[model samples]
Target chain A: MDMIKIIKPGLLTTIQDNGRIGFQRYGIPVAGAMDDFAFRVANILVGNDEHEAVLEATFMGPIIEIGFDGFIAITGANMSPKLNEKNIHMWRSIEVHKGDQLSLSGAIEGLRTYIAFGGGIGVPEIMKSKSTYVRGSLGGYNGRKLMEGDEIPIDASKSKAKVGRYISPGYIPRYNNNNVVRVVLGPQDDHFSPEAIETFLNSEYKITAEADRMGYRLEGPKLTHVKGPDIISDGIVSGSVQVPGHGSPIVMMADRQTTGGYTKIATVISPDLPIMAQMGPGDTVRFKKVSVEESQNILFEYEEIISNIKYRVENSFIIQETDKLYNITIKKL
Target chain B: MYEKARFLPAGDKSLIIEFGDSISPEINKKIRDMYLAIEKSGLDGIIEMVPTYRSILVSYNPLNIIYEDLCHKLRELEDNLNDSGSEPAKVVEIPTIYGGDYGPDIEFVAQHNDLSVNEVIEIHSSRDYLIYMLGFTPGFPYLGGMSEKIETPRLKTPRTKIPAGSVGIAGKQTGIYPIDSPGGWQLIGRTPVKLFDPFAEPPVLLNPGDYVRFVPIDEKEYKYILKQVEENKFTVNIALLDK
Candidate 1:
């Protein structure tokens, strides 16, 4: 059984996939990759299924010692990945031999980074997902963040040893401190005064230090509500924008609770959720309103691009046999 | 007669069907009724449906079905919704031991209401509480129908950690904590029955729309049930109640 031994578990690293879905009815949250785009690309680059479990590292990353010959890809927040003390570019799959050391530094741009291996992280699926819901202590690597010296098992059943897969630079999203995410006014938007909704979209809200996988509490201009802040507790989704009595908005993310009592003003669109997740504390964000129809169109476009990437990664691309620039040949079956 | 349900789109992936704005049995029943309808609709792209106090969160795949089509299908289901879920809901009796170490806040709850601890326990355990929804933590039931006589304000300072199966009263509500987590509800008693066992087949003991009846037990009975629960031999006394 091949595995990656964590020599140094940096910051908050955990195994995550597309999340524990279809469980919100039981008051279970859908905890998945905060940045879904980077997670999928890393898996595609490493020749794994799009939803394969990968190492999601926040701020910094782990110092892992490979125990077998395989391939790995890094994406999302650039954590300055280094293989054997040499710098390695992200969004590309690299082949490695046993005993090779791979390390990553603190984030240079985005808040979280994902590391995908040819074989997915081999954690038993509790509730149909390998994604970690730390608050609930369920799923993924003993249901918590990776600790030092913890040898994470890699499911080699789906391992593909080939490498040299890279995503086009144009396709890789460049994360920045200032972001504008699109949102759709919600189930409880009527609870807020017209002036409050205006303030919410016009004002720039900075992510407070209270940001985590569960949700991000933003500090901005107070949002006035027409009705009281509280609602009969109801189901919560990943991108639901809830406004409590305090007037500040809280953006529910991957590890958000299954239900909440606060009135939700709006919900961030699916296409721009990756951007919302990548925004770190101290980062400022502004909202752009979009219709549900337009938002679904954006989602279709994004899905189409990923489908194209998956096709290319599985069929196209010439892998270089060696370090020489001229050793390119078509990928062999 | 109930008002027409409002269909609100929750982002791109979910749609919220709000039956009403109040927390009552009628609203909960409406939400649960719609939940059953959507579940049996064979509606494409609906990943799952969450029935809350007054709304149902329908999580769907945007790629499979568009928002307008999904809404149209849901409206159709609502128009043709059946009242079949009213076929005698189960009443799960949770055996509890009130006061002493098991219930640290029992005294406070009694003092706040100016009633004897025994009276408080009697009032709390006398009636059936409706399970509105499960949320906050896994299997934590949002119960309704607590008597105003035992109503008490929540702790000014919430406990950092509350043990699982602790029956509590917050305001005009009484419920149980399914898992060990942070909460501020006033603990009136503790139950030996496990409300939530992640390793169990269903994970959670109570289901939405079920009636919860707390049965006050003695220390000896509590210890007996505790041992049985630890050995996984204890079964919650559930019986169908005719409305």
Candidate 2:
């Protein structure tokens, strides 16, 4: 088993996967890759399961040395990835020889970037996941941030292919600084005054620097919610736009607390959360109200695309290894 | 009072069992009763059950049971709650050092209510608190019970980070910060024990429906306990409560 060694931890780097889902009941957050699509793309490029382990580097990327001969891919934020002084294009497969130096820099396009290897980053799994949750100190490299001198084991798995077919830009999520996030009215939307609701949907809010995996604090017109009743605490989901008494809305993210008492005006459609994950401080955000049907339709559309991509990956491997890439056409069962 | 708990859709794949509108102890009891009932029911498709101050959020697989079908099953399970028993829970005693840098805000609260620090400590430690919920952060318990004199508003601007084991008060509720995270609660004191340890047999030190009580200890005892904690040799004194 070969491994990768960190030379410099750029900004904030941590090992993450699809997160620990079963432990949410224990008050453990689902701390996973912020952008699931990009994480999967990186994993797929390296010929690993979409849910395989990967490095979720925040703001900036870390300096690493390849410990083995393997393939890797960079996705999510276009952080100007370079290999031994040679810039490498993202979203495609690249070979790294033993001792090859790979470096990632600050966000050239998006907020977070993921670098996945051929067999995924090998780390001790906690609660059936490699995702790191710093609050509870569980999962991924001992549930902490990647540091210089940390040696990350790499599975010595061989992947067969080069010049891997690229994912269409339409399939590759586009990271936009000024994005209109679509949301559906939540259980407590009526708590806010009509004017507050209008302002929430119409105004442009700037992301404050006090943002993290837990929630994105936005700066906008203060919203006064007419208390219909004191809401008892209940479970909250990711993308829930919760308004604390401060009148500012905090858009909960992947690492949000399991439950909350703040009144939620709306919840961003699940498909759009990945887009929000790539947003950084100073980014402007706008909200658009959509019907329940519309939100489900948007989610369904993405699911169809995701399943199609999975189909391609699963079948493409079979074809390449057996020389059946073109002979066998996929048919839905 | 509500007769039956209804299940509402939390998301496409999750359902919520709302017991009532208010945060009454009875409602909390019913929520716990229903949770235990469902646990005994051995219902399929439930991946997780998160109990809050007054509701239980049940996350299930839509592929196995759609939200509508799960709601029907939950309705069926509600009928079985009459036989549910309030089982005795393990009570954990926590040692605290009151009135110092560890508890800087204790004097402020005591003075506001025209009471002495000893009185405040006595009142707080005398009553048994129920763990209505465990949330806000990993291992942080939303304990329900406090002497009215100690109730205080949260700091105007929350500290960017509060160290784990810092006991704090916010309004009528009191909680301990289980991890080093940002918080707004008024600090009253600190505890030496780990409230949450992922590697432990049970990740959370307390669960909903569990009872907790604070035991006042002097600085010498606190230092002795701190050394024991460092050596991983401390054990909490527990008294089992009868059902």
- Clash-forming residue pairs, model 1: none
Model 2 scores a TM of: 0.85
Candidate 2 structure lDDT:
0.80
User: What TM-score, over all chains together, does every model reach?
Assistant: 0.96, 0.85
Residues B1-243, candidate 1: write the lDDT tens digits. Answer: 246788898998898988887888888777777777777668888898888888888899988899999888888888887686545679999999999988999999888889999999989888888999988888889888888999998988999999888989888888898889888989988999998776677878999998999999999999999999999999988988656
On residues A190-245, what C-alpha lDDT tens digit does candidate 2 reach at each position? Answer: 78989999999999999999899889999999888899434778888778788988
lDDT of 2 at A65: 90
Cα RMSD of predicted structure 1: 1.9
Each candidate's interface RMSD: 0.9, 2.4
Model 2: DockQ vs. true structure: 0.43
Q: What 10-residue stretch in candidate 1 chain B is worst by lDDT? A: B80-89
